[model samples]
Target: MASGCEKGEKVQVGKSDLEEKILETATELFAEHGYVKASVRDIAKLVKGSNSCLYVCFKNKDEILFRIITDVGSDLLNELNKVISKHDDPVECLQDMIFTQILFSIGAAKKMKIYLEEQYQLPPSLKEKALDQHRQLYDLYYNKICEIEKQGLLYQKIDKVVMTFGIFSNINWVYRWLNPIGRLSVEEVALQITDMLLRSVLKNSPLST
Candidate 1:
């Protein structure tokens, strides 16, 4: 909505609010038009702020994109940590993790889409930063699965790498076609997927020993 040339309307957006606005606009733009195609001026225009405001909040477009990716990653890790703290049983914790992943994927579908689909658009330096954070996320899930196996709670011996990838691949692909306005609410989709995944990995699963 922001044309590059119009003067930005002055508003009382605080530092945090302005940063959030820039990230939100960047996410939308990056989602609609790939990250390579979206411009800082476009984002500034949409937020009704000058490019200088964005610079105050972030160094550049890449930094904004990196922040979006890391922010979501941090939130996911925090939620996973909370679930782990609340649940002693590995199975319950894993179920909570699955549910949380789906719920977050639905809630931040646009951000997730940009993170997944436009990753290559970032410069090598920024791209590596994103990749490293992504690896950290994978490690979190992999370590959790390994913990369950170490506790002898696993239904069978499973490859932590394969299992982690399978779970993430199953859920992450939902971003490609998930409909937020479809018949099912986000909670319902999360629940359905959680049940499905738990059924596959639970100690008494039909598919397992």
Candidate 2:
């Protein structure tokens, strides 16, 4: 019962299981300890296995880091999809999507931070896989902006691609200091972020009474 996990409820202890556990553990460990400090032994201790088990499952530490990078990118992609599934007004919908994405990313800051900070350590193929998923997620948002732009719903002069990225950059940086239990609510901060993004990108001028 490594990590004192109960049997059955405990993760399996074979090569396949060890691989999965190591990846999961490493995501957290890397967040807590960072890539240079977190080693195979640390991950093995949590999975009821040995360093040899990890080597069998992964060629090396970089490979394991790569896997974690892929997982986090997939998680963000899923969040983006979930946010857009609702069919609200394009303006409101995009705002909601940005807000939801920022809050969720903040909630998963440990994973997100590790994935961002350690991605460079992964081999080229691993970086490509993670980056490809990231690009697709951005493309989804970018294309949505383009569609709305065509409808005269979003600004035509402002580059949809650049605006989408600018919005993401503002929201993503919050994870550096945000707290789930902090004085500022995640939603409030996210809403403010949306206001800033919308002010910068909205095509239809705000209505004045």
Candidate 3:
């Protein structure tokens, strides 16, 4: 298997069953132990495979982490794109964006945990690539803020950049405290958070009044 790739080239590796198991196990271990502490052998042990067997699917631990982070980021962008395509109203788009993001945060909590906590551990080249995906995600929110502003629905006092990050701040930490068996279902939490965020930004939100 190809373990190394040129700078700026996408890291490609097999996605066979064992590959997924390795990735999944790695995600859990990285989230629990921190990236620096989670060894490739630890991941292989969890997957019930040897280190060489793990290498057949991924080049190394860094590649495994890269794949996990980038895959989650890509999956998020795709879902956000779908939300954008389905909503005509910028407010609606922004609402669904918040809702979708919160849901994703909770649903992919472990992977999101690794994304939040371990991304800086990636090598410079791979780190840049990962950050690029994040920038794209950020821009998606920024663009929607722009759309809302153009329509004069956005609060005049709100800074687009600040608001964008504020939305991220609101949703990004949801995984830490949200309980799956809690009284509120995931959708309920998402909607309530979405409403709170929208109220802060929209000039005419019902909650804003």
Candidate 4:
């Protein structure tokens, strides 16, 4: 584990693989129970470790939640970049961007759950990083919207800033109620949300027709 776990991009992570294992377990545990209710022991038990072993891998439970939040955002941004790169037209990029975000958020429900519901568990240092990542996603959406409007592919009347945030807030908020086993599939929900946003905003635009 030493050779494998020590290769983190940042720190010389001791038992890094075990740390990820513990984090995966704790993410699910905290997502279901919230940070206050879930314990380090539960996470340790999930990973077949003692409490002290868990602490050696992670400073505390708050650090676990912080890691979960940032990891989820990292996963989300990676997917978003991959999906958006498939298109060249700014309008298609914007539309595809919406779909990309919806799919990532719904598919990565546990991570989304931790980020949206359990971020308060993070210490101030990690909390700021998580919030910064969240804000960057917001800025990316706004910049995309501005680019599309400037290209005349989007309705000029649209308040690109507010519309950008509105579109993101509406779509990204789906993780809160999304169920992996629920009536709607992830793709289905993405379609529904995308359609709603399009009809509301794109409906008034010339390019939409």
Name the best candidate (by lDDT): 3
Model 3 Cα RMSD, 1 decimal: 5.9
Query: Model 3: per-residue lDDT, tens digit, 1-209?
Result: 44422234443544476677778888888888899998987886776655777777778899999999999999999999999999999998888889998998999999999998889999999999999999999999999999999998889886789999999998998999999779999899888999999988998895555
Winner by TM-score: 3
Per-residue lDDT over 48-128 for candidate 1, one digit per residue giving the tens place of the 0 to 100 score: 777776777788888888888878877877877788789877777788888888888878888888777777777898889
lDDT of 2 by residue, 107-134 (tens): 7888888777777877788788878887
Question: What's the residue-level lDDT of 12 in candidate 1?
Answer: 60
TM-score of each: 0.84, 0.83, 0.90, 0.83
Worst 10 residues of 2 by lDDT: 3-12
Once fitted onto the true fold, the runs of candidate 4 whose alpha carbons sit more than 4 angstroms away are: 1-14, 156-158, 181-183, 203-209
Q: Where does candidate 4 have its weakest 10-residue lDDT segment?
A: 1-10
lDDT of 4: 0.73
lDDT (Cα, 0-100) at 132 in candidate 3: 99
In candidate 4, position 78 carries an lDDT of 80
Model 2, runs deviating above 4 Å: 2-17, 204-209
Q: List per-prediction Cα lDDT, in the order shown.
A: 0.77, 0.75, 0.87, 0.73
Residue 169's lDDT within candidate 4 is 80
TM-score, prediction 4: 0.83
